[model samples]
Target: MKKVLPFVLLLVAVVLALVFPSVEPVTVADATFDTGDTAWMLVSTALVLLMTPGLAYFYGGMVRKKNVISTMLQSLVCMGLITVLWVIFGFSLAFGEDIGGLIGNPATFFMMKGMLGNQAWPLAPTIPLVLFAMFQLKFAVITPALITGAFAERIRFNSYLIFLCLFMIVIYVPLAHATWHPEGILFQKGVLDFAGGTVVHMSAGWAALASALFLKKRTTPAHTPARVSYVILGTGLLWFGWFGFNAGSAVGAGALAATALATTTTASAAAAMAWIFFDIFRGKKPSAMGACIGAVVGLVAITPAAGFVTVPHSLVIGVVAAVISNLVVLWRTRTNIDDTLDVFPCHGVGGMVGMLLTGVFAHQNVNAGNTTGNGLFYGETKLFLTHLVALVVVSVFAFVGSYILLVITNAISPLRVSAEDEEAGLDLSQHDEEL
Candidate 1:
């Protein structure tokens, strides 16, 4: 009762404010005024902003120390490159007025047409257009960064810059519009991606797979592949930032955001346990790296469903995702594909798992007017079928599109470095410095 008193009082205040509105409602006069929703979004954007650097460290630690800086730079560089493109035309191409259900018109290039004061393209009522842009910027910053993990230790720096430019315009923008735009085919068809299971994770995962196939593997295995400390630190940062990634998707300081926060935490915890158990069963002690990776998989799995499912459902989803991703990673290594950082296993498998489970676990009670109606427990199976269709379409498009892009990139310039460069390592050969 003591703990419940504060919540009770808060609820009363909300109800009173809604019921007995003031004669003149307060308005945020400043475009950047610190309203509750705006404040939350600002913090959320910062959290997601941290993830790019965190991803750099995560991939950096996985590669040999000789190539650590080079590997990390791949992610870091995308932050700047993608942000510039996004401001120029990427946002307009993605979130501008829809054109015949295909793509957004480029009417907002350079943010020229819509001034800072314009609310025409606002994502959240309380947050300014610029704030929304910055939030989405974080998403754009991370997707290409995820791909660097796949072709790490290979791939020329010049070609990579070209690839990112092409990818942001051709791939990420279209997909973001397809899933997120108000009139998007998937969104109109009742697909329930609360965050970016399809848009970000699935797309990045498939692209990573294509990159691995095109780039080929390192000629020799890493001399010392273990960087447990760096991996652990990177994982910790990712976990912290993911709260914004999932909860911030709600776009408001409301009940939905609170629910998303709870589910995200629960799923991550469950996945961590599941990974540790799998390691124990495999006759190895679960290392900190394994546990951290498992937690990330769980978080990814629940990303699309964070605001749609109950906390208990998120736990189940996370555990299942961790187990499946762990097995997939192990199985991929047995083949010659050489997905350097297991992107296909972690993000690809986890995204697929989350998309499907979203259909099973999504409940209308959580968010009224949710298009799916009810969850499996509530006797709705149609949503599950729709999820399957979305998964297949996204997977096929991402994989095929990425493969073609890689082929084109390779044709323009050699994708991998020369044999001498490969032997000497990217840090020394490409950057002229060694970590």
Candidate 2:
């Protein structure tokens, strides 16, 4: 009892922090800007930033110990590489003025003209354009990083770098523009991705599937199975960062942000429970991997609906997403296709489920003007159909583009290492270091 008291007290404090209302309102008039919103976004950006490293650990622990450092480096290196690319041209191509409804112009390259003197873009107010750019930088970094997991333990470092550059230019930027920009085709068509369900998760997940197919399989089975403790720690960090990823999408410190936060938490919890229950029903003990994967599925599913769905509706979305993604992972393992880290199953399947459910559960009372006033149960099924269209289009584009890029990359240099290098492990063979 004595040993557990400290942990109990810490948990109580966290609960109070979450539930307790602030007596004083933190507003912009009280400072240089909307301090409350700025503070929240800043914190959110940092939280989202942490997820890349969390991804590193998550992917790292899944590979053989000899290749752990190399696998982890793929994610960590993207943090630096993508940040520069975003500032240089990635952001402009995604968020700048539309060009023929297909892509954004390079009007804001280097964020030169638009970022002067705390200038605000039309898309988000209260926060500076620089803050918005940095917030998005985290997303740009993680999408390609997610693909690293699919090709883990075998990809050449130089080829991986080349692949990231191509992915950012050819696949990620256009998808991000289509989903996130106000004048984007999907946005114009009324797709309701509050954060990045289609743009980030689906794009990365499908690309992961393509990469896994193109790369074939690792030459060696993992000498050391994934470490459960590392998986748990990575999951915890991802959960913490996801609050920023979802809630920050609201771009304000208001009721919408609160709604997003609530929905995010509810969905994650519900999915975790559902996954555990499913494991028990299958005659297997609940696993840390199941909990981690379930939490991620919930996060992915809610990304498009975080600000639109009610708490209870979000719970349903999470539960259903977990079941679908779990089944998809199981089905994929039965095939020869080796999605090394199940990225397609969790993110791709969860994104599709969430997108459809968002249509079913979306209510006018929540975030109004969401195409349909009432949900599917309320006799409005157009939203559901629209979601299905978005999923199919995004999936096709991602898979096809990724496949072409992989073929091009293979022509330039081998995508996978030699069998001897694979046996020695990527960390030593590619980086000249033993884990």
Candidate 1 local lDDT, residue 308: 94
TM-score computed on alpha carbons, candidate 2: 0.90
Q: Worst lDDT window (10 residues) for model 2?
A: 22-31
**Local error of candidate 1 at residue 86 (angstroms):** 0.3
Clashing pairs in 2: 28-34
Which ranges of candidate 1 are over 4 A from the true structure?
A: 1-34, 118-123
User: Candidate 1 residues 76-158, lDDT tens each?
Assistant: 99887787667656888888888766578876434323434534344465677677878988999999899888898877887
Q: What lDDT score is found at residue 400 in candidate 2? A: 96
Q: Candidate 2 residues 67-144, lDDT tens each?
A: 888988999999987876676668889888888656888765433334645555566777877788889889999989
